[model samples]
Target chain A: MDSYGLLIDFSACIGCKACMKACKEANNLPGDPGDHLSYSDYTVVKQQGDVFYRQMCMHCLTPTCVSVCPVGAMAKSPEGAITYDGSKCFGCRYCMVACPFSIPKYEWNKAVPVVRKCILCYSRIKEGKEPACAWVCPMGATRFGKRDRLLEIAHTRIARWPDRYIDHVFGEQEVGGTSVLMISPIAFSDIGMRNTLPNEPLPNLTWTILRKIPNIVITGGIVVGGVWWVINRRMELEKENSNGKEGKVEK
Target chain B: MGRKGKLKNKLFLFLPISLMALLGLFLTFKRFYYGLGSVTNLSDAFPWGLWVGFDVVCGVALAAGGFILTAIVYLFNAERYKPVLRPAILTAFLGYILVAVGLLFDLGKPWNIWHPMVMYNPHSVMFEVAWCVILYLSVLALEFGSIVAEALKWKKVVNIFHAVAVPLVLTGVLLSTLHQSSLGSLFLIVPQKLHPLWYSSLLPLHFFLSAVAVGFATVILESYTSSKFLKRGLELDLLVDLGRFLWFALVVHLTVRWQDLFVSGALANYRPGSLEAIAFNLEMALLIGAVVLLTIRRTHRSKLGLFFAAMFALFGVIVNRLNVSIVGMLSDTQSGYFPAFSEIIITAFLAMMGFVAFFTCVHFLPIFPQEDHNAKAELKVQLSA
Candidate 1:
């Protein structure tokens, strides 16, 4: 099966947001309304001191949103992009809950709102093209390729510049891995990556409980419901035989 | 005078609902014709409005009486409680219908609702909730079918219904368990978005426990209303029994709830506008207060105390559902979504419909058992004691 991923190398990079500009134009997205509460930049450059952070959907291997949605609205394509179908969306905002990265933004300002996020340009990929963000990154900072090759490349860069690179690949272990990998100079946690997470995928935790719900409910219902039946039957037998002779109802 | 008294009682039912029903009718038109956006405060940020918070999640939980009642009468074999069975079933049926109606208003594309209904999406938690609701509604209807059949003098049909009642009740209980808990599980995906205090693996469990408590509380509330309006004997035994159940549910709910808080270490963040914390606290306090009052032997014995405790528990559970769905959920921008006046009125209308439907059933059918008359005799005997 064909697999794909995006790799962003911060150390080798410039801070120009050509990727964001290309993304907006390529996707026919409207201009930003100029607010933090608003998101026109599918990909943006965030600078903490001289360090520039380009952030968008990490396109996790195991997405939390996919597991939690009741209607299967947000989904992970086999090709590795975290794609969404607004037509299937229920407006529950549960997707907002599942995404630890807080990447999925709901169109809250609009009355008929749906969630919006980067798909790594699934449309372009379907047309056998790279995501506009990677294609337009002039610094050669963002590279799109197979997951295996990206990992090899990321590791080679780190080994080549031990003093310049943080040992950790941002998406390698976070939330059970991601399609998008990042190489940074500082600690990954410095850019707000959640450091404290179990090695297993988050869906594992919820999935374990979710899988057992039907069984537990069936068994719990039978046991609890059985007791109710026996008690009710005995009461019925008594009620019918006594024929209102009793003073207080024996509930 | 006797006929006039009957008419006066009928008037009592209509008095509470007429305006609300009319408004509900109007909104029912508006929601379908105009779309949810026209009349609601729902934004993309807050897609679910009062209808979802108040109706589907909390509304159905409030109506959990059907599951509990079925569990009590057909499963556990609680006999003396039979007097209120019909009323409880009727209350549940109407509660579910109201939830269904409420959902019709909340969906963004109500017209395309049938897509999910027809096309099976096993992965969607919503699909599970929807099927459970649909199947359970029918189960409830079948479980309560005997009552209507009994009233209609369909002796053969009533006998057939009685034979199936146990299984139907069991089905209803099972279906209810799926959806009632699934309601909370719906948020399991929103782990990052929900306020940490309310988010836990045990959400479904919390929902299940609260639904059980609320189910009994709803019946108690209805029973109190029944006693006053029907001039029937208030069944204090059921209240005492329900109180016992509520005490157990409260202890478990409190333990699990606080355990979640304690482990989450989220208790430190408690303050106003921390919707989940406030909601969690309110749920705990309301149930605890109800347990305290009703657990006292004398308190359950009194008509007024029992009535109030039941009402409080009902309100508490309702508030808890609303909080988990709306208030407790967190986003970076804490935009408070107040439901439009029209939204609130539509909710009121549905509630009025519930009461009116319940009253209509009780009046026409032999829903309140003749045994309720014995309460007066029991009271006289107590007086002598």
Candidate 2:
């Protein structure tokens, strides 16, 4: 099955925040939406001068959150949506620390708190429906389709109007490509996106070290055992030699 | 001294410990009753604070004396260092137990801390750390258990543990090697977040090497402090030998750190007056000062000199951990996290608790050498008479 994704056109956004409202409604979130992403708000639209930027989970192909979660609580779905299982969460908040985008937020005010983040409306997508934010985007700013189709649309729009678009897809190469693709007239960095992220997936950094554990264990055990055997044997030999010398002197 | 005087002396020590523990308990209640934000300065941006940095990271590293001493005495048969080995193992056992307690305060769902045991995430560094720590804690318990069993005159149990002493120590050293380094790997995922000066692909090696160095320093500090408090003769010759080992460890650590910094071009990011640079420089200075102090014959052989050098190395390792977990990430996180008063008190309480445990074990158990134990017993008998 083709993985689904969201294509966000920053130029087309009118700063209405209808998508945010739709998200809050669909997620059953209460209270007024905050200016930033929080437990109460899964998605937020921020005004940056003339353009409005929407911030949410990037849902990377190989998400750092998924890999860092010790209990397998945070996971990437086959539908290309990153989902979180609060029940399975031990609430170490490692996901919050590991996320390059700083997407995960903690409910620090709750006695039984779990990490909160955008799940990309995984259930809705499984039901053959687009995410609430994408569906309710009045200006068609947020469009949902197959990842490949979305990337094509994003690149086409960028190529069709060089003066209108930045000629680059924001998430296409960042952190090994995210499901959420963005096209903006201004650089994404100007809108507060991390532009310095490497093209490789973030999880690879940790895996490189973790993969060495088996080798370290086997080698470390052998070295320790070898040292113990050698030291004890030498000590025994010295004891035996000293006894023999004392006996010979007595004779 | 009469029984009444002995009771009074015990009260003198127990009073302060009880008060601090009570206060810590109250604050812990507040923390659990009203959520982390109620008592902590942690926000969405800065999810971790003193609990993770000092309590877990530095705590685990400081406890390295256990594995180091065990490896030296058991593996290499350095019988001279055996006098301090029991105390070192006891410290490590308590250190790990307290680390688990500290995590209870840090985890949002403290109940699910055991999730790592069942839930497998082979790809995660945390998974590796959790397993190693768990296994190592058991190894520590078994290692320390022999001492406890000896004190209780459980000859059969002690004999059983002694039979497997080499294997147990080997397992412990292996586990310590993995988790000590894996703790550094935890931050590897946050390359973009951590400052360049502190971040390196060789972080695991740095962590492991520094842990070994700090382990020696901890053992030295423990020896001096215990000797002073117990009114016993310091193990001068053994400590001088340890000083040599510490010097070598710190030299290797410094060489690797500097080489990595230069090769990675992280030195280019160094601004002399910046916070990270200052922290990095301070850590390097302490470590280098310790090495220099240990190198000098007069200082290396002197008690005060050895104590100060060990203290310097311990403080240096503490600063390095804080720099990695907190200060280095400040520029990228912009969280501006200063730990709350409760956080500070709880950490102090945990550390005080560790000291109390150590002293109590030393007073009652055979944590020290047989001669020392006999001397103390004779002194007590004379006092009672």
Candidate 3:
């Protein structure tokens, strides 16, 4: 089965925040909707002048959080959601530090805190239903479907009405493609999206160095062991030579 | 002085340490009960703060003396430096133990600290570091165990430790090299979050080289301070020889740092009065100053000059670590973080505990070469028994 994705069309959003309300209801979150993502608020909507944008986990195809987690607590689900296991987390917060989008939030107030982030409604998607945000969007702004189908739809929409949408699709290739895609009339950068991320996945940067550990171990072991042997042998030879000379003189 | 005067003198020393330990305990209780937000300045924007930067990162680097001195004395056969070797190992053992303690304070679910051991994630740099640190800590304990066995007159245990001494030292060195660099690798994923001045593809190399330099400097500092406090003759000759190694390490580190900056085009990111640039320049200046001082014949031979040079190099490494872990990320994160009072007090308490532990070990165990003859005599008696 193809992985699911969400296409957030900023141009069509009327900013009713019905999707935010539905998300709160679906996730059992209480209190008024927050303007920024927090432990209690997994996803948020903010206004940048006339444009409103949602901020949440990007759910990268090759997630940095999953790669950085020492305990495999952060995982990329088969359905394209970046799921987290609180029980598996030791709370080192490397995930929080490593996220390029700065998505993961910590439950700092609780004594036994865990990391919090959007899982793209993993359970709902796994049951073959759209995420609550996409299901409740009053203006068809947030659409959920197969990632490849969404890409095709995004490209067709861009080509059909070039004046209505920007030439670029926001998460199409950013950080090696995110499950959450976005299309907007204005530039993504203008609405506070991180536009400077590299096209390659972030995890590759660390893997390039980490993969050399075996070679390091083998080479380091040989060099150190070789030096130790050679030095000890030289010392033994010197001691033997000195003893021989002393015996000859005494004799 | 009489017995009464000696008791009073000891009491004077004990009071402050006891008070600080009590305060630290209280703060730790609060943190465990009330959570990290109650004790630290950490937030979503700054998940890592002073504890990670100072206690764990810098603490691990400062403890590099054990593997370095072991490699030099055991591998290279620099037996003349053996007098300082035991103290260096003891200091490192204490440093790593305290690093583990400090990590518990910083971790949210301190109870789950053992998850890294059971759960495997080979791709993560953190997984590599955790494994290396755990294995190296065991190796350090065994290396330090020989001293304990000597103190206890355990002839059989001492013999076993001696039999495996070479292999133990080699393993310690290998583990240290991997984790010292892997600590820097932890930051490699955040190219955009970390300031470019400190962020480069060569971060692991930079971390490892600087650790080697600081390792030598720390051993020098340890030697001078221990001799002064214990009323022993200063090993001036051995320390001066160590100074040359420190100077060489610093020069190599400085060259690599600047060359990486140039190659990465991060030099363009430098601004005259920016905090990151200022911190970077200060760190560089201290390192260069130490190298220059050690190069001079007058300073190289003098105890005061050598001490000052080592001090400069040590501070240089500390500043570089803080710049990488904290200061460099401030501009990108846009969240200011100053350690809370409780956090500062706890860190100070941990440092005090380390010092106390070091002093106690020196007083009790045979940690210096000058004590070797008597210890050997005791061992012979135990063997004959």
lDDT of 2 by residue, B190-306 (tens): 999999998999999999999999999988987886687665534798899899999999999999999999899998999989998899999988999999999999999999999
| The 10-residue segment with the lowest total lDDT in model 1 chain B | B376-385
**Structural RMSD, model 1:** 6.1
Ranking by DockQ: 3, 2, 1
Model 3 misplaced stretches (Cα beyond 4 Å): A245-251, B2-5, B230-234, B370-373, B376-385
Model 1 per-residue lDDT tens digits across residues B1-385: 9999989987885665676677778877776566666677765456666888888898889879878876776576665566567778888888888888777667655545555566555655676777887888888777667677666667677667765666777778888888888888777755555667677778888898888878877777767766776676446766767767766776677678778879888777677665555677787678778878877878867777777777777787787887778777534326577888888888887777777677678778766666454653343223211
Worst 10 residues of 3 chain B by lDDT: B376-385
User: What clash pairs does model 3 have?
Assistant: none
Better of 1 and 2 by TM-score: 2
Q: Which 10 residues in a row give candidate 3 chain A its minimum summed lDDT?
A: A242-251
lDDT of 1 at B112: 51
Report the Cα lDDT for residue A95, model 2.
88
- Number of the top candidate by TM-score? 3
What TM-score did chain B of candidate 1 earn? 0.88
**Candidate 2 lDDT by residue in tens digits, A155-237:** 88878889998888988999999999999989888998988999999999999888878888898788779878887877777
> Candidates ranked by TM-score, best first?
3, 2, 1
TM-score result, candidate 3: 0.96
lDDT of 1 by residue, A44-93 (tens): 77776678878889888988878766667777897899888888776556
Reference-based lDDT, residue B248, model 1: 74
